[model samples]
Target: MKIAVYGASGYQGKLVLTELARRDIETVLAGRNRARLEEAASAIGLPDAERRSADASDHEALVSAFRGCDAVINCAGPFTSSGEAVVRAAIAAGCHYVDTSGEQLYVKKIFDTFTTEAENAGVTVVPAANDGCVPVDLMAHILADRLEPVEEIITTHVVVGGGGMSRGSLRSVVETIDAIKAGGLAYTDGDWHPGVPARRTAITLPGQSEATPVMAFPVPEVVTIPRHIRVRRVQGLTEAALGDRLNTPLTPEIIESLPEGPDGDGRRTQHFTYVLDATGIDGRRARGIVQGPDTYGTTAVIAVEGARRLIAEPAKPGVLAPAQAYPSTAFLDFLVPHGIQWIIEDAPAT
Candidate 1:
């Protein structure tokens, strides 16, 4: 099956192209820079892959780039500014769409604005189908459904030792820093409240004896988790310093001054864990923890694998959370060979 990798020359996009190559999947390298796209393909040993120069602002070019593909894995973002055009192009091309966005606002926008048109075009638009979004959503469903109609679902992400941010990642930070403060958005009693506190200060992640200090940070799961489970509330948290780091104002010049991205060895040094807790109405609780290596590396797998699943079978069209598009168990299990591990267990009496 043929898939298109938009922003194919960027760090994450090239990683995705590498994953597709490993899977022996045919791909189209699509982005604004035809030279960089060609370089990316040659670097990945896919010298024969078609290179399409489709700038995000050029709608017609984007559609043409994706026209014959079964799906498009969009790796171009700070999605807030340019995402809609890409989504529109994918739908117009009548192809399934997935993107590696970590922005909550972008995720919400896709679900809100594209649902009708995506369904009408019979294309599944899965936004934030990446390392940060998908696993947490899937794990939330796996845990929350067991205690359906739960009072709350809390998701925390702990990342230890990773290469510094890529320039593109830094750009996303510049795009989202203001909105990410104070926990992004929280789902409460059937309504989403923005810029709220996490109401939690410390949490003990799985396998840790001491609790790590945490603060509310915007995570895409805040938009996704409540959709599948009957939880009255959902909140997301990450390390306190991480949440605080958003305080550092990022400018285009500052991002350009940073390193291009991590090398393969630096990427391999990253390890991430998602701890999802679901509390039932009766105060009973369960927690699911998904652990994996390499944040950007895993994202490549998630995006490519997500595209493969969408193209493998048709799902009811429209916007879908990652778990909504694929089975939690199957997808999580699929990551077993990728140095990923996870488990669900009863939360200790509190």
Candidate 2:
């Protein structure tokens, strides 16, 4: 299948291009920078794939760039500003669309505004195709489905040993500072509530000695899971330190000085552990944990994989969450061999 990667020269974009090549899929390296797109194509040894310059702000240019491609994977962010335009272009071109946007507000917009348009165009629009929340969203489905009659889901993410955010990731955080400062978000009683702070609590990790302090934070999963599961409450948690850093505002100078791309060695050394606990009204509980590579690598692999599956077996057209857009276990299983380690456990009512 032929896929076009907008923002092809950026950090996550490069990784997406690499994985697409490994799968033997044809690709188009696309962005506003012609030289950089060509350079990226050459670096990935995909000299034959198309390289085109198209700015996200130019609708016609994006439509032109996306034409003739089966799918388009957008790696550019602060998606609040750029994501909808790309989605519109993809729909206009009748191409399936996916993006690595973990921004909750943007993600909600995709589902709210584009679901019908994408369905009419016979293509799926999937957002949050990243470590930010897709895996956790899928796991929520797996565990909730297994337990049956799920009531509440509490998910915690630990950056294994901690790591630095990629420049693009930092930019995403900076772009959404207002939302972060309002505090973490959660879903309860069919409405989203903001101004929720990360509640400090101790939890045991897979191979850890003592319980570690983790604080609740907002995640896109809180928005995506309800599309499939009927849970009444969903809450996200991450390490307190990282959560604090993520909510911290960035100055214009600080944003300008951030590295333009991910450090290869630095990314490899970074790993993550995500744990989800589900409780039923009957007092039964289930827990699951997923460990994987850093955010950029994980997002790249999953986005490419999602594209591959969408091409091979298309989802019923619409804007859907990662889990809703694909077979839950099948999609989750696809990540296992790619270095996603997971374990799910069940317990009787307490």
Candidate 3:
């Protein structure tokens, strides 16, 4: 299976390349910076990896880069700007498309506009193929089966350690904050409602030292999951520490003040834990916990494995979420052998 990766020099790009190498799949690394692309491919031990120069923002260049590839994995972010162009190029090139887009608007737009075209083209287009929807998608599937009439679903993500964020990721964070400040709308109460950042709230994780404050944010998975599952409400939260020792709120000012390069100390180790809770009409509930590495690395792991499945399995052509594209058991089975742990529990009715 031959795959072309856009933004193939970023942190997530390198990790995905590494995972692809482990699976012995051929990859073409395409991005804006030729030098960075070469460096990342070499660092990941893919000496024979093909290199192509293409500006992600330029539609013509993107189309040329995607031509003749069986699949394309997009790690480019701020998807609000570059996503449509890439999707159009992938569709024109007759390739399966997958991305790590966490922007709700882009996901919805693709579902509405390109889903039919992709199906007609016999290509599979998957958005938010990373941790953004995979964990929550799995949780929602689990709860949908256990609960007779589910009312609401909430997912809280607690990420620890600063694992070297890339420029693309930083830019996405800034854009998302800007949108929130402008009073964006989120689906709530069975309708699109105005949404804002978290003021301040404390919550405890299973293996954490103490309770920490988490900021509620709008993520694509929150909107994506509810479309498949019958639920009245769904939300997502991202919680991180202020520093090495204190848990500080992720205020807009702080998000604005983040430095550009060398995001954190080289010795820094990162951790993440997600709690998924679902409530049903009969008072029965289900909760699941998933823990893993830094955000970028985890995303790469999911993307690479997802692509491998697409190559190795018999998959129908269409846009799908992680949980929908691959069987939940098949997906989770691949992760466990790679050191990811999942804990699932069912609560007795009270």
Clashes of each: 0, 0, 0
Model 1 clashing-pair count = 0
Candidate 1 structure quality by residue, lDDT tens digits, 256-292: 8877788888888888888888889888899988888
Question: 235, model 3: CA deviation in Å?
Answer: 1.2
Model 1 stretches with alpha carbons more than 4 Å out: none
Error of 3 at 86 (Å): 0.9
Q: Name the weakest run of 10 consecutive residues (lDDT summed) in model 1.
A: 174-183
Higher-scoring candidate on lDDT, 1 or 3: 1
Say which candidate scores most in TM-score.
1
Give per-residue lDDT, candidate 2, residue 74.
Answer: 94
Q: For residues 213-285, what per-residue lDDT tens digits would candidate 3 score against the true structure?
A: 7656566776667666777767666564522322234555664576433333431255667787777877888
Please give, for residues 1-350, the per-residue lDDT of candidate 2 as tens digits.
89999989988899999888888889989898999998888877888888989898899999999999999999988799988999999999999998998888788878889999998999988888887577888888898887667788888877555457778877887888777555467878787778765544877767889887876665788889878888887877776666667646687688779776557877777788888888886788988888887667888889998877788888889988878878877878888887888778885666
User: How high is each candidate's TM-score?
Assistant: 0.97, 0.93, 0.85
Over 4 Å off in model 2, which ranges? 160-163, 197-200, 243-249
In order, candidate lDDTs are 0.87, 0.82, 0.72
* True-structure RMSD for candidate 3: 4.1
